[model samples]
Target: MKMFGKVDVGGGLSDFWAYIREPRPHRWAVWGVALALTWVVFSGVEQYLIPVDRPKAQIIYFENWTADRSAGEIRADWIARARETTRRNARKRAEYQRFADSLGIEYDSTEADRVTRETLGEEAAEAVKQRPAPPPRSTLAERAARGPQPEITD
Candidate 1:
């Protein structure tokens, strides 16, 4: 019913046009100041302001295969077999039995490897000294705990 306030939503553009249409120095100076301030505000916002729609990275992720280790017992059978390969190494079989007996658990290659490493101060690389051993057992727990076995390289 009544135009109460100077709330022309898009009427500012006509003022801009009016300023540019006249050749008065004051109008150009006003236009120049507005242009500078607009650019300053815009650049400041663009440089400093982050977008709301930008996907905020909740977690930075990276993957590496090198540092991984077994989540379960390392294979014991491979070590036993490796020991068996050498003439005096059959004694490793007896060690395996003894370890299992001591632990009150079944003789598992994984467990044996763990025992060798933890108890005997050894690494699985000792068992597969010069050759690649067979693949690890395929039981569910074994598969879950087992990591990628190192290849016995030349």
Candidate 2:
């Protein structure tokens, strides 16, 4: 006997081939019938039960919350709101005008009416420079006339 045993790979594969050569015709027919029945059942269920696709715009809906409001009511409300805003703006403008006036800025309308450097001249500037500086001291009589200063307890 040889040391290595003879392998029979070819014989095993040929046996498998011979089994496939002898086929059962009924097996293919049974598989075909099962596939046909499954397809028919699925198609029938999909046709009647499932909804068709539609545009998103048509499917979504919205209702106006202001539908019950009358035209006159809307007009009146807008007019009142506008009047309030106008009043606030006018008050702010008036306050700014007052502050500007306190700062010695004249609101001259015409270019000819506006004050200029030539009007004051060099003589007025000289006179201002020659005027003596006032004393820093505040007299007791002056303080008394103005009334007593408020006392801070803290």
What are the lDDT scores of the predictions, listed in order? 0.59, 0.60
lDDT accuracy of residue 6 in candidate 1: 66
What TM-score, over all chains together, does every model reach? 0.23, 0.27
> Pick by lDDT: which candidate is best?
2
Residues 1-154 of candidate 1: C-alpha lDDT, one tens digit per residue: 6775667757788997786797875876787899999999998888789445677679868874335456342356455555445324334755665666655556545554454444334444465343343343466778668877788989
Per-residue lDDT tens digits for candidate 2, residues 1-154, read 8755887889979997787567787867876999999999899889867867866765657874478889998887787676566446544544554555656455432232122113334653453345344335566788889997899997
Find the candidate with the highest TM-score and give its number: 2
